[model samples]
Target: MARATTAHQLHDLGLAAWFGGTLANAVALNKAAAHSGDAASTGAVANEGWDRWTPVNAAAIGAHLIGSVGLLKHDLGRMSVQKGVGSMALAKTAVTIGALGVTAYSRVLGRKVSQHHAVPAADGTTPTASTPPDVAAAQKKLKQLQWAVPALTGAIVAIASYASEQYRPEEVHRGMLQRVLP
Candidate 1:
């Protein structure tokens, strides 16, 4: 019970951080960096912000993965017997994989932009007229990917909520009955 509780806490905390931080950055940080007075300063500001967040985000992802493994281990028997648990687990796993892939790709793009910190930029993911072609291309892709990361994470959160509801005592009883009767 303690192990399960810890795993649940870690999973929820890590996921919340990952989702909130990315969304905050996309919604405010990226755009706000442009207010630093110049295109070059904008790039520098955005680079610094994202660079600072990298390690923390990595830790959050690590925690989330560890917790996911712990929770899966704890829930294996429940999943085997419960009607909807296996499907929920499969769906959540798929979403987690998608979120991770998007996050990794976005980080790669971020690095491409950050490496050229002195380069001119309209904002974090927006390129200026004088921005180099390569960095500009990366920024263009990141502009799209920024939203994707959060959206997928948000989907994970939503799915996890649904899965939690499935664990209610009544839900479990009904699901088990359905499994046995049908």
Candidate 2:
């Protein structure tokens, strides 16, 4: 069994953090916030949690991107010669880009919603409702995006798993031969 490189470890750990964080936010944080009281309070609570998490999430994403580049550099030869590897890489890249976009859009929506709500300063007090039509629309969009972030991150995790399986020696050999032969 070969020891995993630093890049591989970072890539896996970063991805784990990204996936786990998104899922936790969706399942636990959002639900807890929704139970906080009215719509404004819910948005404020959820936004506050996400705001606290943004820095950590950004770091995880940075690490994952850097590690992915390093891993790709290390595997350039196999990427060029292997049959399925390039396709899987492309798929992973596409999903990653999509996830990034969704995350950004979700943040934008969150910020828009936050503008109308009175976020609690320190005390865990329920905020007053001030949901204008536009803010309500933004909140709706955010609700959908909340689930999307997790779904996309989970897809990335699945793609990473597939890529790992493709890295097996037997799989790599078969992939290269298939490219050359067919």
Candidate 3:
């Protein structure tokens, strides 16, 4: 019986950090920023926090990728024999790619908002009473993507859970036998 390795720990921990951080930022940090009253200050505070978290998030993502590769290398034989493993792996990969895309897009939108220092009107002037239509549009997009980051990461966590369940000794033996027999 092979015990789990450091790679698996890294993979799980890194993913947890990535998922939890994204959710925390969306639920808490963003709300706090919005509560600050001044729209420009809200953008500044949120942008600053995200900027500070960027390096840590990058490290977490890198660790998860590295760990995923290591785990895949170690489990290639099991994965080949397991009936559902390949499909689950593929799904996880797709979700990961989507999450990465959403993260990047959110950052781009955040940068645009931060650069303007306030939500600009459609005509490119700052609004006094309400959010400018252009800025509102960007914010709307960013809001969607921001929520998406956590949702995608949460899906990955669920996928990982399924993979873990599939790694049980009985499940592994059954999978291998199914492959050998059929």
Candidate 4:
């Protein structure tokens, strides 16, 4: 296989690891919530969920963006187009749709989480990962930050789709054709 293929495969693997890792972290957070009763600690699961998810979405968006571009590059000309039609086309369409769907879903979830409210701690302090706040305002802020994942992911998906459209092989090749042939 070509180096590019190897790189793509590695990138995909990284994404899979991150997604799985994020979910695992979420699970761990739930367990922590179950085991602990400290007011500062009760919602740690949601907190960690917010933390882990941000990077997960960011990584996912990056991977999809790159993948779309890669596919577009592979889709130019007669032989390539022939390979892309049928099952390949279906697969491509699925990926595009899935990215958009996930991005939208993530955004919605992020918004919901952000809107959630919590009581302020008796002591004034910004909630840190180490000191999970017992208060509502802090909880709300944490929830908003949790969406870093989805927002980043959506941004990535949006950018990749744009790149795929812009760098489409035919478009890239058109410029080449004019330069070379004319």
Q: Output the lDDT of residue 156, model 2.
A: 86
lDDT tens digits, residues 52-171, model 1? Answer: 998999999888888889889988998878899999999999999999999999999899888987779999999999999999999999999999988999999998899889879999
Query: Candidate 3 has which clashing residue pairs, if any?
Result: none
Error of 4 at 104 (Å): 3.6
Error of 1 at 94 (Å): 0.3
The TM-scores, one per candidate, come to 0.98, 0.85, 0.84, 0.46
lDDT of 2 by residue, 1-182 (tens): 12237778878888888878977887788678767665657767877887788889888988888878877777777889998888888898899899999988877876776675544322122223445666667766766777787798889889889989988889988998999995
lDDT string for model 3 (9-54, tens) is 8788889888988888888876677655666666667667777777
Clashing pairs in 4: 54-149, 118-136, 119-135, 119-136, 120-136
lDDT of each: 0.92, 0.75, 0.75, 0.46
Give the runs in model 3 whose Cα sits over 4 Å from its true position: 1-4, 117-134
The best candidate by TM-score is 1
lDDT of 4: 0.46
The alpha-carbon lDDT assigned to residue 96 of candidate 2 equals: 89
Q: How accurate is candidate 2 locally (lDDT)?
A: 0.75
The true-versus-predicted C-alpha distance at residue 74 of model 4, in Å, is 1.9
Count of backbone collisions in candidate 3 = 0
lDDT of 4 by residue, 110-143 (tens): 4443333221122111333444333444444434
**What is the TM-score (0 to 1) of candidate 2?**
0.85
Q: Candidates ranked by TM-score, best first? A: 1, 2, 3, 4
Candidate 1 segments exceeding 4 Å error? none
